[model samples]
Target: MLSRVAPWLASRNENGLGVRVLGGADTLALRALANEDAVANVFILAHLESTGTAAPTSGGASVFGVFDGDTLLGACWAGANLVPVQLEPGLAGYVANAAHQTGRRYASIFGPAETVLALYSRFEQLGHLAHEVRADQPLLSISGGPAIGANPDLSFGSMADFDRILPACAAMFEEEVGYSPFLGGQEFYSKRVAGLIRQGHSLVHIDAQGTVIFKAELGAVTRDVTQVQGVWMNPELRGRGQSAGYMAAVVNLSRTFAPVTSLYVNDYNTKARATYERVGFEQVGTFATVLF
Candidate 1:
């Protein structure tokens, strides 16, 4: 848990209306704020539920909160990526300012479209330029069974499939992010994949030859929602009209962890968007990502 005595990053009036590192005492307030939009805030909420606000994660990640006097209003998870929770566009500047003061370089800033763009604008003014900005990613969710038939072969991944799953995950990451996740070192990325598999979060379909056919992970999970991510299909199978069935399976499997299954996708990816629609997902909100 974060220390209550942790120095304030940005203090305002005596009533404490400013951005600062959240401590264990602020857990309830933070949860209340994040739960306001559970589906959209699942990533941060999952982290909080699993790790608490006691101390930073092994990756030096911490939750930063914005307050209006003593009442908590918004939060951002400062980690590999910046995930804003219930943050208004107007308040993003304050969070961005506080984040910038830490002198940390983030892989990306992502969340509700307005807030993310607002935060990115602040960072831009501070001389931080992005390699790419996905300004309009649709956040889609499904609460009921998928419309398409689920692929029976798709199932939770295990260590026995780790070798195949790891490389496939890396390929998806590189193709999406424009850089290899293994650029820094493969150890960290490998551990993340293994960890997800160990938690039963990795979902995959591997062929007899040990090739990953379809893969996706329940990246963020809470009792109410689970966000699907790292969705991928074998290149040889593209345009074979197979994504819907696989995605239907993802939706079905995801329900074992949470009632709602959710994922966000780039606006330009019309094919993937259509596949999700075919699987019964409905657009719930918009998200944006500014890759650094």
Candidate 2:
């Protein structure tokens, strides 16, 4: 593994560049930037927060960076059992070599559309398949306007509600998000959900009937920017003009935490795009998700 990375590592040195695990005082600054940049990026940054907390099982996760003297040029981090974040412009060759050196099969990645295409091409040449593409875009706006409709009873979900809501949560994730960790069993799923909630990074909306309709996994509360993620609405309640209301309420509530807030929508999800637009979110940039 070291042998495979040697030449590339040497090349970086020749350019007065070095790559290693992130460290020191700037860790907080880097983490803040990643949170502002993107929520997924923030989640990756969370891994760097090993302050008395158990390091998340790398499972298939790792972070690397490219630096020139005191300047950080780029960095990448893959989540446990998920695709890695590819933040650099042209380091696909080095990435692939490193992956092979580590004896991994393939790496999942997501970022700007063009970057994904480039990495996909590079990975394909190395016999890896970048078979699935999830087209999504970061939607952002300064939140302070009146909501479009009546506010539903909304609150953060409690841990005790997990048993009743877990199945629905799993189904919504599998259907809309196209992934389900619970397929392994309730244990893995429970722990993952608990970890997210314990981080105080998720929001839930329940109707008067006490049903979970809309939920979003949010990132850390930092700066004036709050990030919305893993948004889900009950499938049976789609097209009732409710999504707009839910989004508006979430945004309105988020303002108490941060001045700026953002979320991502699948490019192919016109309905969601329209709903979000109705609530005042503007398209920032496109992101590509490569499923391995």
lDDT by candidate, in order shown: 0.89, 0.60
Residue 137 error, candidate 1, Å:
0.3
Cα lDDT tens digits for candidate 2, 47-88: 554442212243645555556787655555534323335455
Clashes of each: 5, 2
Best by lDDT: 1
| Candidate 1 lDDT by residue in tens digits, 11-37 | 343556788888889888888898899
lDDT of 1: 0.89
Which parts of model 2 have CA positions greater than 4 angstroms off? 1-14, 24-41, 44-61, 81-86, 105-107, 135-141, 145-147, 177-179, 207-210, 219-221
Q: Per-residue lDDT for 134 in model 1?
A: 93
